[model samples]
Target: MQDHTVISSLIVRVLPDHGESAAARLASIEGVEVHEKLEGKIVVTIEAPTVDSSHDTAASFSEIPGVIGVDLVYVNFEDDPAVAKGSQR
Candidate 1:
């Protein structure tokens, strides 16, 4: 872990019949924010403590019931924590 903040945005697709349940489930996950839902697609944002966790979180979205796909739109890892790890501040 680099002590950096990792934020990622993604789209999750599900069958239209399952959109509501899937969106609720996704929003219940830690650090997962469900932004919008239309048709069978949902917009979401995930905030994780590390880059690897961000990936893991995204991958887990596929396991949700009725989820057809998880498409990552963007990921940002704030700065380089490694550069300041040795400093007291």
Candidate 2:
């Protein structure tokens, strides 16, 4: 088996079904970390054991009432075959 990992960061710009309260609600999800807040958006970072987890976290954010959309600002992974694929030395 191969290990798959991913790090995802999203800038959620909320139209806010309930203003800051909406943002607050989204911040409550597990494994989701709030990196910053500016204007009407919250920046969140999610680290998961796999790509699916990362996407699941994003979906959670989208389920929030105030969430207008999620802008993926950053994503990095360590499973690329070219860089560290077999560098086990």
Candidate 3:
């Protein structure tokens, strides 16, 4: 196995909806990057050193006025047993 550090990412769908400009601004944040953005829902992916960094990025998204909610869908090298097995299988 290769020695690698786990990099967690947060997939966020911006809520309350807003303009493409605002979403662009959100994506422009230092560590945040936009993976996809359609309509009022913007999918953002943030990679950080630790889970806390992921959570911190999520919290930053919530700070955006139009943002309604933040959801974390995946993390680096997901720790789920089923997922791990599925990857191998």
Candidate 4:
């Protein structure tokens, strides 16, 4: 089966005191990348093989001890292997 690539960006809000820890936790999750972090907000990008997986990754952010909210900012899905290969040419 061809892989479906899903890319999403999220904003995660955490307790001010736990910002660093929360960012580290988020970075530890598979397929999650911490792009930027402020006092209590983190910008993250999740790359997965499917939309469900991407959503699951984002949802997991909310389960962190100090996380207050998870907001999805952007999402994209790419499922064309031929187009993917063609792009590389």
Per-model CA lDDT versus the true structure? 0.86, 0.74, 0.62, 0.85
Off by over 4 Å in 4: 1-4, 80-89
In candidate 3, the residue pairs with backbone N, CA or C atoms under 3 Å apart (3 or more residues apart, or in different chains) clash, namely none
What is the alpha-carbon lDDT for the whole of candidate 2?
Answer: 0.74
Top lDDT prediction, candidate number: 1
Model 2, 5-89: lDDT tens digits are 6778889988744547766786687667787777788888877766667787888777888788888888886754433555665
- Model 4 agreement with the true structure over 1-89: per-residue lDDT tens digits: 43548889999999999999999999999888999998889999988887777877888887898999998899887663544666798
Best by TM-score, which number?
1
Models 1 onward score TM values of 0.83, 0.73, 0.64, 0.82
Clashes of each: 0, 0, 0, 0
Model 3, CA-based lDDT: 0.62
* Sort order, TM-score high to low: 1, 4, 2, 3
Q: Model 3 — TM-score against the truth?
A: 0.64
Instruction: Please write out the lDDT profile of model 3 over residues 3-67, one tens digit for every residue.
Output: 32334445445444464665877778866777777766777666554555556667877777667
Candidate 4, residue 60: the lDDT equals 80
